[model samples]
Target: HISALKKGRFWITPDPYHKDDNIQIGREVKISCQVEAIPSEELTFSWFKNGRPLRSSERMVITQTDPDVSPGTTNLDIIDLKFTDFGTYTCVASLKGGGISDISIDVNISSSTVPPNLTVPQEKSPLVTREGDTIELQCQVTGKPKPIILWSRADKEVAMPDGAMQTESYDGILRIVNVSREMTGTYRCQTSQYNGFNVKPRDALVQLIVQYPPAVEPTFLEIRQGQGRSITMSCRVLRAYPTRVLTYEWRLGGKLLRTGQFDVQDSTEYTVSSLSRDSYGVYNCNIINEAGAGRCSFLVT
Candidate 1:
């Protein structure tokens, strides 16, 4: 009787094992456990986490094998391994003869994908202006890792002077100091990122044309009486780029006078005819060019 009891009884009741030793986060893995017992007609299985009983609603599933042939094989599936599931797992089995067994398994999860992408946006080219005039140059870029931007002039990099350059990280804006003629040249914007394996390089070129205001203000501001009873005012603009457009206006007592004798010529010369005492208080010539506007005023007696 003692020999038969020993041969029919199984010592180990549960054996647990993990599908893989290492797994990445956000992936699926399986955990299996087996139990061997005599007279498996009344056998119960339970799973636990870190020595604590696990609930069925804890995203864990258990399946029982054939009870008549191999009642010891039970499988537990844990889908979608997460960082929080990196602890130990245990399986418990119970039989009718007060037989019980438990087994433990461990799981580890990690990351296995590359980083995010980085992008840079198009920037507006710098504008050209004359010396002593306020000039602003701006560049904008965008990226996931937040790319670093640099500004250069004439192939030489420029640094922010004392309270000269201002930067807005949220808006990705870069501003330069007061611009001068020496500051005019080919400006380039370079962007780079160190988070990726290869450094991403992007650049944009802008040409700055420094133009001076209409040089040599128009001269020859004179009023003369003609042979007939007509007054003529002649003005000439000397050495003006873009062939400045000239305009002549006559004022009396600080009030503009209406005259049908106003003339404007593209030959850098302006003349007005049929002028009388009413159009002889003050005469002024206005010269304009792409750079800026200039004026010359003279009093007529």
Candidate 2:
């Protein structure tokens, strides 16, 4: 069994009951062993207990991978530890063509282990920040065999700083630079075993809010109405940071005709009592918030 280091290799297990080789009976233990080797795809793994070759059973399993966690890594999982399970377990790795000497690790399991636990900072969700700012999302993970940390987007794929789009990241802290509106959403931090264990991993979530200027559009670009008929002109704010229109300015041609405050809605409407010669012109509605201002205009006849 590998020792639990705060920062080091990957080890995954579900509700591990011991730390290192000291495991309690009637519990589960997963030993993740990795070796440095080339042509990892051609490497195979074998397990032996007390010098006897071991095989997979209902309570025991062995798995090997080339690129999952690293190049040459394997996992030996023994469940429901009992007195009979106490012994020196050895893992042997050998290349298919027998190019290099076989590498092995011996783990003495007497019987106890700690399971992994994951948590996030309180009230850290809905993290509000402006665009172009850098942000870091973190998670607190603790376990006997410290689990691997994986960062991921709860709803979409994450964009890494290196321009690679991936569903998950191995780094413990997720740093996003020059943030954009597309980065707004929920981010999930979870305990990962990479490719080692097949048990359910613990997870937590935090949200990111990217604030920016508002974008607006006119409900009607152009309208034609007969004289003596009333008409309503409306402007819709497409998107904004503050999300509230503090001030609204209605201008006829180049002069401001009316001004008011709208605190409840993003959309505002102006009603022209009667369509007359003086009312027939280009009317503009400008909406202002703390972040920025946006305007929408329409022509009337």
Candidate 3:
């Protein structure tokens, strides 16, 4: 007799990524948050400071690690700590099935006027693109002393799989040419306080959502999951971008598989919840995103 299969869940690691520091205003600061979940790719992150949502800009920044890795991680950074930067910072990790977890810290930021005021123009909402298209993200940094501009990804490991692509303009604009689906992730606009003692450290963030209409149909393959006893039929749709906006549903031998038709793991990759000889059949995976709709069928037997 075979034991029953288990479902996935979400959780987080305890923190004080680093103890909060009491620093003078001209200085910079950093904080990190770590979270883990089975099939971690489904976890979405949101950061907060002093009870408010924090967005990337000259004064604030956030980034994440590849979820496919163990104990996926996220970060919170205050580029050039300002008087207004002092407060409690929080990191919230959420799952679509409804579970949520978070961690918080109190950062005692001291005051200083030596560092000039650092500010960045508002970041536009994320843009949609097809494979092989070029995208440009622009930001303007304004301050008393002209500051140096820099660019980085919120999730470097996942976004820049091919290493650094040097397309930065002298101004605060970043451009990508002949882009691939994997190049999608949040990009940051940052500035340097070259005024010797400095005035302030500032940064900003923008999101790039990539959408690839199915390059190839979905295919089924057997994968190892348990102690050599359990296995799954994996349905993968290649080159799907902006995966967060895509919807997935399953079918067997041309018949629609409802939510309760059987236990299943729904994601960019569809996995049959239970495995048995009886589970073999022609499987169809359906995906829909702004780019368009895609469907694929494969025999598991």
Q: Give me the candidate number with maximum TM-score.
A: 2
All candidates: CA RMSD (Å): 23.5, 9.1, 23.5
Ten-residue segment with the worst summed lDDT in candidate 1?
1-10
TM-score of 2: 0.53
TM-score of each: 0.37, 0.53, 0.36
Instruction: Name the regions of candidate 3 deviating beyond 4 angstroms.
Output: 1-123, 157-162, 165-169, 194-197, 218-239, 242-288, 292-301
lDDT of each: 0.47, 0.71, 0.54
Encode model 3's per-residue lDDT on 150-239: one tens digit a residue: 577776734343366322334666777877677678877666433211223466777777777654444444334433243333444565
Write model 1 residue lDDT over 197-236, tens digit each, in one string.
1233565665665655444344434555643355544444
Residue 213 miss distance in model 3 (angstroms): 1.1
The CA lDDT at 47 in model 1 is 70
Please give the ranking of all candidate structures by lDDT, highest first, separated by commas: 2, 3, 1
Clashes of each: 0, 10, 9
Question: Where does candidate 1 stray beyond 4 Å?
Answer: 1-136, 154-172, 176-186, 192-200, 207-279, 288-292
The stretch of ten residues in a row with the least summed lDDT in candidate 2 is 1-10
